[model samples]
Target: MTSPASSKRPLWIVAATLLLGAAALWGGSRLVWSAQQRDGGVRGMLLETQTGAQHSGALVPLAVLAVAGVAGAVATGGWPRRVLGVVLAVAGLWACWIAVDGVSFSGFPPGAPVWQMFLGRALTLLAGILVLLGGLIATKRAGAMPRLGARYAAPSVKKTARDPDTELWEALSEGEDPTDSA
Candidate 1:
C-alpha cells in the first residue's frame, strides 16, 4: 500500500529552500554592517563601510555550504543526502554562533543608527535558520527523495516465458512441434 506522500517527492520545495538560504547568505555578505570614518580625510567627509564578509570570515563558508548542499541534494539521495543534511545543519549552527557572538559596536560613530549596524548579522541569522530547515527536511525524508535523472531511467528487459533451447528441444523430442505450441 502506498500513500500520496510516499509516492511523491517535492524536490522543488527542497531546492527552493536551499536556494533561498543561499541567496540570503550571499545578500548578507553584501549588506553594510559597520561604518567608519576614513583616515586622513576631512571629518565625516568619507565613511567606509564593512559588509558581513568583511566582519567575519565564517559567513563565506556558510554561504558556500548552502551552495554545495543544493547541488548535493539535487544530485544525490538516501544516505548521501542525509550526510549533506548533517553538514548543512552544523554549518548553519556555526553561522548562527558567529553572527550572535561576533557582534561589535565600536565601528559606528556617534549619532549613527546603532540598530542598523546589526543588519548583516540579522541576514546571517535568517539564512542560517533557512538552511537548517532545509537540512532537517533532507535528513528526515532522504529515503523518499529522488535523485536527478531518476525519471529518465531506462526500462529493464523482460524475460521470455519459455527458453527456446531447453523447451523447444524437449518438445521436438516428444514429437510435439515447438511452433505448434506457440
Candidate 2:
C-alpha cells in the first residue's frame, strides 16, 4: 500500500528541480552576457588595465553553466542532480573568491575601479548563495533515504526462515501439509 507521504514525494522533488532550473537559465545567463560585452576589443583595452575584467572570457563558461545547470535540475532525482548541485555551489564560491581576490591577493596596482570591484564581488556572492540553496532544496525534496531501521530490521524467524520441523507443524496446524509423513 502506498502511503500519502510516498505518493507526494515525486511531486515535491520535481517542483524543487524545476524552480532551480528557472533561476539558473534566466539569471545566470544574463550575468554572463553582460560580462562578455565588457570584454571584447577596444573596451578590452580599457579592461586590460583593469583587474576586474583582465580575463573576461570567464563569462563563456558562465553561460554554459547556466544551461547545464538548468538541464541538470530538470532531470530530477539521483546522483547526477546531487553532483551538479555541489558543482554549482562550488563554482559560485570560486566566483566569489575571484571577485575578492584583487582586494588583498592579486597584488595589482592601486587603481582598480571601486564600483566594478563591488559589482563583481556582489554578483559572485549572489550566485554562490543561489547555487547552494538550489542544491539543498533538491536534496530535501528527494527523500531517497530509508525510513527508521526497517531496512536493517531482522526478518521474522517464524516465517521464511522457519525450521523444517516448525514449518511442518505449522503446515499440519493449518491442515495444508504435503510433506507430513502422516
Predicted model with the maximum TM-score: 1
Worst 10 residues of 1 by lDDT: 152-161
> lDDT score of model 1?
0.76
Instruction: Please provide TM-scores, in order, for all candidate models, with all chains considered together.
Output: 0.70, 0.45
Could you give candidate 1's per-residue lDDT for residues 17-109 as a string of tens digits?
Answer: 777888888888777777776665556356667777888877877887788888898899889899998888887777777667757867567
In model 1, where do residues sit more than 4 Å from their true spots? 1-10, 36-48, 104-108, 111-115, 152-182
lDDT tens digits, residue span 1-182, model 2: 77868755644543454344435433432342121113456545333333333434453365357456655655544565567666765655555555455443343334444445445555555655555555565455434523234444555664652687877776665568556567
Worst 10 residues of 2 by lDDT: 29-38
Give every collision pair in model 1: none
lDDT of 2 at 52: 31
